[model samples]
Target chain A: MNTVWKENALQVIQDIFRNQFFDDSLAITEHTTPADIEEWDSLAHVNLLASIENAFNIRFTADDMANIDSIAVLLATMVERGAC
Target chain B: MAEPTHMLMMAKEHCKAGEHARALEVLRSLASRHDPLPMQAQYARLALTIAQGLEGLPVLRVAFLAGSTLDHLVGALRFWLLLEGFRLEPYLAPFDTWRQEAADPSSGLYSFRPDLVWFFLTARDLKLEALWGDQPQQWQEAAAGRAAEVATLARQVLATLPATVLVNNAEASATRVLGNFEGSVSWSAASLQRRYNLELAQALPAGASVFDLEHLASCFGLERWEDHRLWCHSKHPFSLEAHAPVAFAGAKLIAAAKGKARKCLVLDLDNTLWGGVVGDDGVDGIRVGPDAGAAGEAYAAFQAFAKSLSLRGIALAVCSKNDPDLAREPFRSRQGMALTLDDFAVFRANWDNKADNLRQIARELNLGLEALVFVDDNPAERALVRAELPQVAVPELSADPADYMRVLAEGAWFETLTFVEEDRSRSRAYRDNAARNACLAQSSDLDGYLRSLEMRACWGDADQARLSRLAQLVNKTNQFHLTTTRYSEPELTALSLADDAWVGWFSLSDRFGDHGVIAAVVLRFRGQAALVDTWTMSCRVFSRGMEDFIFLKIWEVAKGRGCTRLEGAFRPTPKNGVVATLYDRLGGSSVQQDCGQESRWHFDLVAPPPDLTHYIADANGSGN
Candidate 1:
């Protein structure tokens, strides 16, 4: 566990989310809605999901991601997955 | 706010460059920024908290419980807290109780409808932890029983919560926990991970994959203290550092790992073997003494290492830029050199571009370029080799003589996972290949040369026995690959098990030598077309037209299966340009084109080309 791990994970997730959602300002937060982040396409979603999984060492089922539409949901999912 | 944003960008840049301390400074700067708008201020505060969290600083999360308007901030804080590995028990308790009371239809606060109360509680707990260190052991003990009670209640409330809300809570919590455990662990980190894994598993519906702290730990090699040093200073728990070891260990672990070169080192002599030119020094004049004054010590160490690799099943070969007679003399002379001519399987010491020499060496040794690691001290020589033959791994050696052996030994790129029985005889096999090549070069007719050796091909579905060799070819054979698709064992398993797909591999041998599994073809049946997903041949058998024979075999299989045409895609890559015209040369017509289009070749099975006679059909349909 180093200082960089969390930051790196956060940055990578952010970059992926931003790139996929086409919105750089979208903060990865509990309340951030997927609808607000335009880059949340199906492919981007899967890529972000996989990237986050790889980054944090957590896995998400399709159903788990299906309902996760906001930054809050993502954060909660990370918690539920024991990655947080 | 803009300052914070700029600081954040700078910090991110520094982190990418492997400067963690510098990144922390920027984050600290951002944390000091002030904003007028509550939302902006709260965003900055959350960022500061996350930065602190990354640094392993436990600060209690600040809460805005004044009104419903603060709900968003509360939720955001909760998300950050969970990512930082803080427990959410204290935060969820009040929300669960309120939900239970509100459901009775008799509560006055029912109209209050705390949409973000749970999120607020989560944020407050984090703020508490941040401002005050870890919660007191007594507080934790007292809260543990109550926490469980709250969790039970929360579950009941959670059932009625919007899916988005539930998912958001879950995601935020998981991220915080994962972030904390990813690179930093004390007693709290491990316990948090364990507890969270169970909690998340329980909270998540069935079939949801949980990315737990343990999984993150292993994926990033976080369990090992030494490995943690790679990413301990970064913001994210996972990065290139986490994956580096796995990449290093990838050559070894087969079940979850992928492509690796075989355990045979085809070495170059002359400048490669010793510091001074070997031809100029002669056997006796060459420096091999332990004296600090002598340059030959490095050569001696290099030989010792090479011998060690040989003992470990790595076959050694000599491809030098020197007189064959002069090079052979030092190895055999009584002056007691560490390496002898017999130490190498194939010794090709001639005045030829090393690339061509390497090609000859591969052919003579019956090995693929992918399996060979060419080490030469000269930059020009290394570059020439790299440009002409990209498949062969030509690692650049240091000009400093002292680092020669150390570089070879420590570099994980050449590491091997498993040593098989045939590895010991690799040198001898190459020696036979050299003899075979010599015989073929002397013969005018190709068929006569192939027949003289009495070649045989063995075809079969790859099994555990041949997995290593198959992987080696896949990793190293770059020139003739159709798609050049690389696969780990798991990926290969998926491909093989996928509907309408099959992997066919072939190994060739002759009285000359056994050319271990050197060809792999991935065939996919898609509707009317039998797509050759991946097709590659070892460079050793290039001019012999083994590809033609292989193509003919594939055609026969496709024709029998009632396929109209066999389609092959030639995706151009940096290395495979040598065979860019393969489809046109192989009698395949182009059907379509797109921007950055990989050349698509379609061969109607009704009129397959006449089989070339250069190779005699062996038991496995491979040409001799």
Candidate 2:
């Protein structure tokens, strides 16, 4: 994988997490839960899915956006979708 | 802990957490709290009213405000009512008796509170007619009289209050609303500033700036509100991301009210402005008669609506893919045609691709492509224009001509500020541009073209006569622009007066005709670096290299002032791809590369590009 793509992927992950969580200092981990950040409410979960899709220039199915709950699950979904 | 304050905090938390339904539930519970203190009751009522309004629950909003609560609730109700499309008169009716009682000073209402009296009187006066029924003429007259009396009382209260007191009152009472700022920062900022100016003039006292809730909202990517908890929690009431219709409507209103309304409505004729293709239908076969038939009536109605837009001062132009003579015959000969050839400012009826035809129309009208809203019923045509001329607002229209009028009316296309004098003169200005083009086409050499047409370029500050044109160009010009910067009218005014900014516009005319203010250049001086923030030339003079001439003049001014570097930026937009290579061709080196950094271009005055003979030198030895 290209180093730039790896960096961009991490940055995209960070942006999605920060915006969804409203914690600028948020460090995206594989185990982060929706409840851990006060700002990661139901609406932010959907927004995070959409942002990730846009950053990766891919489409997320309704099921995909709805099913993902944790950062680990989201990352797995992205990997399954070949987004990273 | 007080139940109402506790509920308020919970609701605030839910609202911040993007759980609008949960927030609304908490607010409802707070409002239903039994027999609370007067202050608590008032706060609860206000909170419920705002929350219900945000939730799009008009019934709940009305119930909370109409209750026998404190008088401040009346003011909150009035604002919410306005937001929900109810006129001011209906919302202020219940406050009349309180105002009269307060006037006596010893009355029970006066003993309760002096501020409440003012609020009651102001609300009543502001909305008198709606309180009193419209049926009885005598009652209506009485309501009007009371309204005037209440207005006087409100003025007295305002006059009695200190400046600081009024400011504090305004700050506390100001409603927090959301809007879309989707375009350039200059355009958005100028529009907000204009609204700030107007709000200050109408509601706020002098020196008060309308706080930009939109800009504040944008700090959290509020433009994409599913990302902003403030918006997602408000039930998508204020964010462009969640509610594009509402956000676009808010932005359009702000833009229109500031007299920054777009200049031209570039329309596609066949199946768009009219029912059938003129080439096939011939003038008579076109569905444009006042007959009772559905299709015929629809076409006639659409034409009438298009014509009515002219009365509102929106210039209509045509770009049709048909023979010019055949396409134009309907306007002149059709029995029920409402929009005539004279109604259009520019008409490009040729078998050329619509995108090209639209480009010609923009050039002939001396208006910016961004100022145009192209309406074509054909999806393919709309898509082609969308791909080719992305700057043009080509709204999708139904193929069934019957739906055209309603679509135009309901869609925020024709919404604008007050129609000014220049609007009526727009059609004639395009006619002049056509003549100028014809003269230019006749000449072979550049100098011969300039001399034969007797073209004179007037450059200076925009006066009252030309300010509107200058504003339109600033807001709309995209292609051939050094930087496609959009500005509202008030921002243009500010730029004209700013010491560091040199704003100049040119009106070019030859013996054939007058091209009304077809070019504008805005230069900002920051210490030693001079920046060409906005440099746009009308598309009509694109091949003429009028921009090179303008840049030469700008360079002279910059050189004379001892400026070190002449910096200009070409922001690569989907529509401005034509200008992507402009800086490179003009001898400016790129200093950065990124999504947004594609716009930055810099030129040092120490090195000048090779001179070209394209520009004709005016008698003063300066290229005009």
Candidate 3:
């Protein structure tokens, strides 16, 4: 993974969690799953993804969205798509 | 036991810990105990997290009756309302239930008894195929048919409920049936939708509001807003991206419904209103008004925007740490300046602290600090007001002067659902109030000042034309309201029309200018006695003997209506302490005294008080 892209994406994701979930202590890792955060429900997942797209100024295809559920896959997809 | 303030602090900690439900519970408990810092924006921020799950915080019941799917909208709206320090309980009608729910009073939708109803109809419901078909003769028929249907629905809703109804305009479909020829077709989908929205707006009664969703959709870009996958999956119309903006817009309308709209826009002069400081640059060097430069034009545009806001009834005030004469120079001498000295209700241009100046402005205008929006380019000054007066909204102005207007408008501090004539003429009225103050300062004593002003008060029954303003006074007047009961226009109108109700409005004018509808009195008759349900007056008219005059008028009205006795109550709220001794001043005797909540007072109307009527001219234009 590109460390710069991963770091940038993680910072943006952290802000989204802080704002949307009131999770100021939320620290995203490569292995973090939806189960790790109670507020990472379906509605919030969509909101988080949309916010990420806005932050990066990139559009994700349906296939990319369907596969990018986990942080590891999200980072890989961002790298593949050159979003950061 | 933790103090209420400590509980509020703990609630903040709970919110930060992602225990939003607990945070909300704590906040609610604090609210129940006492008013929990009502104007604190931080509390509003905390509400966003758990509002979707939590219920019962003085809900403004809203019924969503729609033609298309609206499940995606309800949660979004609830979240935004909560974020704006409001609780909303949504009653969602089944899909395609707009016509049925609007037409029938006994429909399941009426069970919620919504304070506001939103009609979310789409282009699909109009069956655009019939309008855009090859049959050219059928275009007029199709258009009329759609218009009639929407008009019928509007009428049914108006007749059925006293709720403020918002009808969403149909957005044009991105799909092109006629391809390149779509622009030429008179009854194309876009044209039909636009026409329908226009007709619907005209057809809706005065109480019903049109949401203008078509314009909003266009602004968001039609293609990006309508998610095909979501539509296919769950009949969701708006994209996930559009949720916040749409919800915020709806919440603005809802906030206005509850009279939570901010009133005044207090401005800072140095580097905020003008590009350069008046003290440092001098009047000629400052970048304001015409032909100064790009920066000057931007400042000029900002002034024009502020002027427009004043015209919309938002009072303007200036709080600057400069010489009063120096501050007056730009408005006095500068060419192409949109704002004038008369535009502002109060101007504090001394070296006093900005927050203290803001408080002075609030006191002079008889407005709450919560109603004030402080706009200062200086981050330090904004921080000062935010710290000292937490109730005042200090919006962070952009570094770029050009973006000031956009930032202020987007802040949505003064978002109101209805803009009556009273709002449009509010600035002029306040300017007139300044004249009255000047006259008062010049006079020898209280009676001398009152008699010198040549004040004329036009008293009448509160009718349709004045109903909205009466309700607005009831909602916003805190310090001077005797029994702070907020009512909507419909409820106020119903009260005005009731046989057992006496609704009186007082419009006072002097040698200076007209203070339109300065006071409102609502009385409910109980056999031979009358109960003062609502007695509210503007703070601007305070100590002007307007209160005494209105009290006498209320007594006369009750007597004329064959009521033998009159009663009034003072309800204790965080803000209404000023009116606690109001009944005592009116020569009223204590009747039903509640230790904490309310104190009721009774007055026998058989004999009136000695004439304090030297100030106001009679209703028939007869001078005192």
Candidate 4:
């Protein structure tokens, strides 16, 4: 169960980042942050968050909108919302 | 369960990857389909890629003066316009700089000279915040002050430019502090904001039109209307997906202003109008009403919707590949039927290709093929027509009869800003043409046939009462328009009052019925030449010698005004090819050809040719 959940969550996050940024080869680890990618600006960050929220059927608060800049924060929000 | 929306995006994606052939196929699919674009078009970067590949599309300069961030919305706007065969050249004013751009004449807004200026000021933009227990007068004061500012800005835009201005009504407040009682509270944010929208719409300048975002929010559902989290991050009023409808509404408004609105809704018989085939299952066996159960009721409801559309002046037509009597029997003898034979302007039921039938229908109704919106239940028939005559809009109708009315209404093919008595009387004029056609078959020769109809015409100076029809003629008449110039009703009124110009309207009546205001003319009295700036006639009277009757009066009025020469230009369009040699046939000499695209023609008024002959007698008796 743990292995299946991790794979599915990883696939969903990867697909959202790939489609949203239109970069097919893009890969993300939990530690990845805005400083690691040049395309993840403030506007693109909102787009990425919106895509993950839609994919997970969840909502984010205003604090999360401004503070969630790394893949670690996104996974934490997704798990807190019972997405995993 | 593949939605048609997903398939349409293939065109842009394929074109992005340089797959030309696949892109062409999907673009063809997008063209043949009906309804609006989907939300996936919000990717601004992708839309630019698709737009860059398209060649020779008409360009509309649009300026967005908004209080919110517009970086993401511009892509969806350009995507919708591109789907409608127009490329959007938009100038985005800096965030919250609308007041500065609209007031300063030398600002970038004026220098861009946009054809459409979109003002998007949301409720938040106006600071209509909900109060816990503030004074009731506070809400009213804020609403009224913002309303007055919008009205003043609208006047300034109209005074500075002649372009069409689209002002979005503020979205009602999402915070319903009083819940169900919010509407009843005078000082509540929802109540005050609603009143502010009404005041702004009513007080706008004559040329500006409201976009009605409040009504759009209700339809789109206020729950998902705006994202608060994204608003805090980007200052965008709504999420990217919600901008789809806004973009579509803007494109349709621009299209209607340019006279690209579809005029006719052509339907098929058989399973289309009833639950069963009319020919296979006879009129009595067909199911089409409340008594015929569920499927029949759906067809009946669709029929009622068509009747309402005809009342609003959208010409209805029937095109079927069956025997004429069998196809029309349901309307003839059936009970509980919403549509009757009289509702349709033209009925073509024969064993011919649907595309050819549509061509004949357009010819009989005196309309361009682009003016038709064809609806059929058969996919093969829709595909054939789409491939052959691409100008005709063939909707991707489902097999379910219940979805017919919804699909057609969502197409919004007949979008118009104004409706007049003239529009309501359009079907009557087209129906009269049928009787005239039957008379033509009985007469022997052209002259003898026209004489038998007993046609009488009335010509006079176009006044306010005739402004609607005159504007329709000058703006929408594609064929036989000498100059093809467009003018709003207000502009036309101003031109009529000028001393050096003459604007006249002509109406014709025959034994069948009256065809009201069939032609309009605008002539500028130059020193030695009376130039014809505009000459547009209804296509319904195309071959009835109406042009001959109209041109005789043209030079006669110019000669009476003491002009030595009568001059005009033939500016060509795709649909105006029928009138390429109009001035030449009118005994006028071609003086100059501008790059072989537009030509100038002249007629010597001092020694004008003999007046053209027509059978119609003058009823007003003022134009000698």
Give DockQ per model, in order: 0.03, 0.02, 0.10, 0.34
| Model 3 TM-score on a 0 to 1 scale | 0.83
Q: Considering every candidate listed, which one attains the maximal TM-score? A: 4
Q: Please give the ranking of all candidate structures by lDDT, highest first, separated by commas.
A: 4, 3, 2, 1
lDDT, model 3: 0.77
Q: Pick the winner on DockQ between candidates 2 and 4.
A: 4
| Candidate 3 residue spans exceeding 4 A from truth | A1-84, B1-13, B16-57, B68-72, B128-130, B133-148, B178-185, B607-614, B621-624
> On residues B459-553, what C-alpha lDDT tens digit does candidate 1 reach at each position?
66656566556555664566677777764333444456676876777767777677666687778898878999888776555665567667777
lDDT of 4 by residue, B71-132 (tens): 66777677667667778899999889999999999999999988778898777777776665
What TM-scores result for chain A when each predicted structure is judged separately against the true chain A? 0.69, 0.77, 0.87, 0.86
Q: Write the per-residue lDDT of candidate 2 for residues B1-624, one digit (tens) a residue.
A: 357656766766676676756665555334421222232323333344444445434221111111122233333334323332222222222323544442453544323322211231112123212222234454434434443443444443333322110111111111212234312322232233333323333553221212233332343343343322332232222322322232234334433433234667777777776667778877777776665267778877888887777666567888888888888888887787788887887788887898888887776665667678887788989889988986677665776888877666544655543334445655565555666676667868667765565555657665655665776666555666656676645456667888888888765555655555678888989888889898877665565555666777778767766787888887775556666777777777777657754557688887774374444344344543
Best by lDDT: 4
Scored against the true structure, residue A34 in model 1 reaches a CA lDDT of 60
| Candidate-wise lDDT, in order | 0.54, 0.55, 0.77, 0.80
Fraction of the reference Cα-Cα interface contacts (below 8 Å) that each candidate reproduces: 0.00, 0.00, 0.00, 0.32
**How much is B426 displaced in model 1, in angstroms?**
4.7
lDDT by residue for model 3 (A1-84), tens:
768867877888776666566556788888888988886765566556766776677766666766777898987787677785
Ranking by DockQ: 4, 3, 1, 2
Worst 10 residues of 3 chain B by lDDT: B32-41
- Give me the displacement of residue B493 in model 2, in angstroms: 4.3
Root-mean-square deviation (CA) per prediction: 17.9, 19.1, 6.6, 3.7
TM-scores of all predicted structures: 0.48, 0.48, 0.83, 0.89
Better of 2 and 4 by lDDT: 4
